[model samples]
Target: MQIVSTLRGLMLGLGISLAGAAAPAQAEMLDLEKDELKFGFIKLTDMAPLAIAYEKGYFEDEGLFVTLEPQANWKVLLDGVITGQLDGAHMLAGQPLAATIGFGTQAHIITPFSMDLNGNGITVSNEVWEMMKSHIPHENGKPVHPIKADALKPVIEKFRAEGKPFNMGMVFPVSTHNYELRYWLAAGGIHPGFYSEDNITGQIQAEALLSVTPPPQMPATLEAGTISGYCVGEPWNQQAVFKGIGVPVITDFEIWKNNPEKVFGITKEFADQYPNTTLAITKALIRAAKWLDENDNANRREAVEILARSQYVGADAEVIANSMTGTFEYEKGDKRAVPDFNVFYRYYATYPYLSDAVWYLTQMRRWGQITEHKSDDWYLDVAREVYRPDIYLEAARLVVEDGNAAEADFPWESDGFRAPQREFIDGITFDGRQPNAYLELFPIGLKGSQKIAQNAVVGG
Candidate 1:
């Protein structure tokens, strides 16, 4: 009778141990400075991390009740973040830097986490695609991908000969799309224009004139023939292919592999005043990003369904699934496998590296939006001011301690820069430490003591 009683106790102890091992560790919920919070996002598929966090209970796990609102446009979203109407928003990687530099609206904003990577594509209208088909190389009856703007050059020339302005659209003046489109166009011997203080049109000395159009309107605008082609985020790009109006010729992932995209931006004043709340929000976002990419994107199909809801992306589940499910559709019926098209956590996508900030600043300078020659150290200083890796690592540490994230997942020893990157479409290498020297590699853009004056590049 004594032996039987002892065996029963041992069995109970073993069961409890097994259950504890299987359960995920929960981090101690911080005392949030302000528990109920409001966040904003543009209606795009890359905003999935925000939606997933709210839906999958990551935000609730951190004892945060977050209200995710969709703003009308990027400008309104940035303004909301600035005016404290919104706690923080999903922001363009350039919005904070541009705001600090006083490009449009002057406000000091900072980002603690990068939202995702490589979720944009460049699409051209059907007429433009038809015109360029002969110029592009064909493989297995499909157009050769990473389609250079060189293929569209003759179309522009024909328009120029016929006295028609060749206009293309980008989401904003200081956007990754603007820079990537310019890079791809310039690489293919087409000028996508420049920005000058005197002329904010960004059409100085250009073969293809570029202008601004909001993301959701990209497809309708292209269909209406307001612009020939546009560069924007998904599933708008996929929306075009679905509507049979435009063809996505190239994705930003092909242009620049693993390029950083959106960010979770907040005011520095907000961070300083409510540090604990900031950490809590970042922790929830980090966990959401991990779930988006966990088990090799096992959760993406579910994510696509959530993002398809009206309050989030509001696009069809099928359209969102195209890129969200590790495949991308270029031309209609030309779906191809692109596994890294929407990277959330893999490759340290959430870590807001200072070097990534420097790259955007350099693009601003290269395109004359900065309007002054900034020193390399100036670039680093601005980067450190806006990109807060310290806050990110702190939040990451909390996640790690909870056993929710692996220690090897975060870059603990990084000096906040990736090694020099050389996978550009033009085959030029960019070292963040030498912003000016890196700018000089581009044959087309302004570099070193150069400024735009009177609708022309002057004083290099």
Candidate 2:
């Protein structure tokens, strides 16, 4: 791969004169504040950018000797970063925000890089799927795509009639899976519940109860009847299909098209102390992200192999490839083309957009994880504090200077927010600039000055 990169660099150098383009400037190696670094990630395929950066020599190219450690779970991963055990980790988009605002653990965490987009799916056990099949529409004897949470609504009601709680699993409270699962459920008129100051279980006034389960444990937990369904990142969702234990009813892509997923999170203290190291790390990750999506994902098969190794995601290559290589499996033998299922780059996936940060904050507020109503300016300020687009754009500039990426490949002129997105499953447009108004659009969840008090929503 290094040889190929060198050859490609040489060819580009030769082509510059022929094409009458000015020669690309060589990027100077950053003066190291820290050279040897350790990063952590949960065992999910969205961690691919970190793994690819390490495996493809992008980290070494930036003079970084990186150790990519697989963490036990999201909390352990976040704690590792906060305590300086790991420099950073692939994090849930809301982790840094929740931490900064003192939700669970109070620490000032920040992310300069957004890892990937739309890499999660909500899966239900075989029993639950069998029950839901009748409610779901079909075409050509297969269930229609983007199967809404309405299909699960009747099933949850049935469970209620049977005097049982309809339990579901998400990776963490602040995880994209949690918000995506809740969003999908609420869109179909099933309340996934809320989190209050006293009750952090996030099951207040709920139809389906959501709890944290580690990503790798999702399939087993579902099979054990501990959770009827789960929302998690690959290859666990694909793993369930491989084991015939569950069916993935929907991908987060269908819930919110191209929604921002994971971010590479580090403490503010670390970034402040090792500014050059932060830029260097971001540059390498940017290159890795570009490679993952380059040539229409021509390198995905290779990426699957790397992720399937024991030290990485450790799932079967075929299972990892089920979604990583531009398709996703919903039910057994129901494989379909979903080209954007796991986006590492393209669509500015790596840029830490403030709007993306604001979207997560909105979800945090909607779900009661945030106890008080915050103004729109508060949302923007929190996003600015946590999502460092300045660092990300600087790294992008350096990567472009190094001839490792095209200037066109980045949102160099972006104002750090995406244009208001409207591709949600429920058809509600999200204007990040007006978060409170967006909150008002939701039927379920906290809005305005509403707060969960004594087991009910009040003060709206």
Candidate 3:
């Protein structure tokens, strides 16, 4: 718990004068359908927006009284949201998509807000790090950054020859970590396993086995040697470096620049029934995000202290600041400037872009979480159903009018897609509109009606 006096004062008065102006902007906050709400989040640094909204009284200013609870894991958090036990929760970008498609749990979950971007990293234990050091290229005595998983292929091969299972961990079955880790490994010619309808271990044809381990437990699990590596969000990756157990080899930012990571999810039933409440929540979150990235992240120090509160992230302020405040520590003390490592508001981050939704669906399909092949229109339809950018713009309009955000800060006229993205570490371009085409681009995963039949890939 590291909240300081200056941070407390800053939290109390954040954009107070603008609250009056913001109130008149739109239909976001009405005579409120529901004012008392409970939201759940995992204790990761990206959950800062939720904490900031509560501490800065942003939710209260929007005529909402909110309770923020930390959940046990991704499943429990999603269950709470689906069961109406929670109004909403911080979620993996794929949870709403996966749950809605009946991949895991069947629910009509929707997100008006995409939380933060590129807040995750892939960490390798010291033993694994030592194994990879010789294979990685170096510049001026420091290992070259954006270290590809190609460097780890030999290490996995060694484990394979020795008949040892090279275990790795990810936060969830549908987490961005799972996808990002898979993407990195596959790009380097290492098979990262697959998911099948009958066999859901996702270790089919894996060179290195990946399974779920909660983010907070990652450092300890790596230290105990149960998992040789993991892909997870901050400050857990930073925790590994600080505890001297592991070294983060690559961040999601390098794996895929500015990748969409997490979202703020609520059931579609909740949104339709209480549209105004959804708008209000979105607005408070938008304001909090702006505060986070404004003025070149000038407020990040204050945010770090606030997130270190006992009930919030609960990690040391120093560890959280490692990635949250414009830099990331890889091998302990081998820090580098990674300004967008934990993007919150910038780059239209909060918008629930349909392209972002489509991208998640592609990963689900590529890995066989989606058991059948569907048309591009099906992907587009799901994107439209799950991502509500229309509602996000309504909230953004209020933020802009309230003197908090600029008009140019949002993608006001986007047709729910981004241009073909080509920043992946594999150098593969992803166009959200061409999902099947995206699947075909993969070298080592299910594609085009492919199914895992009898523990093997059957169709193409």
Candidate 4:
């Protein structure tokens, strides 16, 4: 790992102050148990925090040496962290929760920092878009924004009537893309499918079959006519528009406003073994997230350039800027100002809220990934185990003490839960404190004592 020799000199050259007026009288350095670390990530724009931390010397500011490597996919990245091949990785918000609950890979993964929010979109192939366009409301010769999946329901029905199965893509089974796409489809009265202990395929009783496609492969896969549409993170969704093969119908922000997306995940053993190192990593990530959202996103243009490099997201700067700069182009020329499209720090985004973890667990149970009902307290317990707000607050306090951030920037009194969120596309309310009751409101998912059996939902 390459260590920056003089972090103060680097900051000075960058023309940024290391201290603020509210900074403590003395800045303290942590005694890191581990300084040299390599982290992994997928090639998505939401990985910007990791890139910025390394490029802007945030890691060095904490006397740490770091390397960021892009992994092939979410599984490889998770496996890397579990096997100790990587210290940590940019992870799907669901990855750590699923891992901790022994869903996919049984490991005690914990997240100290949430990466970013609302950077994903659901896009359809040109043919499907043309079919759904007429169903969507229009104004001034353009499709209205937040095109509901109701428009796609008829299209899927048409496919079903013709004895053709509609297929869609998501990055992983436990990904936010899957849940968001499922949420959108079900809200529109389209059955996205379900998972069962007997059927891990998740396509049992489906209207649209959802499958996994790596982020970078989504556009090409759509173009190949393999899947009619997909839900994935930026530059890929924008890549489809740039390639003129598909049209993004709605962003995840429209599906659920300011939703928690990715996280900075490390193993529980790693945190226990190197407590200060974990705190340092979280501090650096918090700083990077703040930089990404600071000054009303004045730095996004620079962030786009950094993310466009070969080692980062590796997409064209223009493609990345389409969303990173706060305006998202949905249908080619239909660019709209979506300033909060990719929130990294604002609205307490970096804080690993326990409610965020509970939300994912609710989705897992709703879709049969949990295989059975769990108590609401069980959900909160798992969240408390995996989503470490204590570590996040400690890191935030240190960042404020260093004078790099203001004390007001962190949510000092949060009880690890946000107020009940009511912005879901279905207009359903989700209270993290009442996971089971929340699940009961969803019309198309497993709830209560319900479980999937023999390709049918049974025992409600």
RMSD of each candidate relative to the true structure: 8.3, 5.6, 4.1, 3.9
lDDT of 2: 0.90
* Model 4 clashing residue pairs (backbone): none
Which whole-number lDDT from 0 to 100 does residue 351 have in model 3? 88
TM-score, prediction 3: 0.94
Error of 4 at 203 (Å): 0.5
lDDT computed for candidate 4: 0.91
| Model 4 regions lying over 4 Å from their true place | 1-26
Sorted on lDDT, highest at the top, how do the candidates line up? 4, 2, 3, 1
Writing each residue's lDDT as its tens digit, candidate 4 over 1-460 gives 2223355566668887554311243377787788779899899999999999988877877767787888999999999999999999999999999999988899999999999989999999999999999998999999987899999998999999999999999999999999999999999998888898868888989999999999999999999999999999999999999999999999999999999999999999999999999998998899999999999999999999999988889999999999899999989999999999999999999999999999999999988899998898899999999999999999999888787899989899999999999998889999999999999998899999989888888996
True lDDT of residue 97, candidate 4: 94
Clashes per candidate (backbone, < 3 Å):
0, 0, 0, 0
In model 1, what lDDT does residue 62 have?
72
List candidate 1 segments past 4 Å from native.
1-25
Instruction: Choose the strongest candidate by lDDT.
Output: 4
Query: Model 1 — which ten-residue stretch has the worst lDDT?
Result: 1-10
Estimate the overall C-alpha local distance difference test score of candidate 3: 0.90
lDDT of 3 at 416: 87
Clashing pairs for predicted structure model 2, backbone only: none
lDDT by residue (1-460, candidate 3, tens digit) is 2222233234447844333432354444455688778899999999988988888878876777777888999999999999999999999999999999999899999999999989999999999999999999999999998899889999999998998999999999999999999999999999998888998999988888999999999999999999999999999999999899999999999989999899999999999999888888999999999899999999999999998887888999999999999999999879999999999999999988999999989888888888889999999999999999999998889878777788999999899899999999989999999999998988888889888877788875
Which regions of candidate 3 are displaced past 4 Å?
1-29
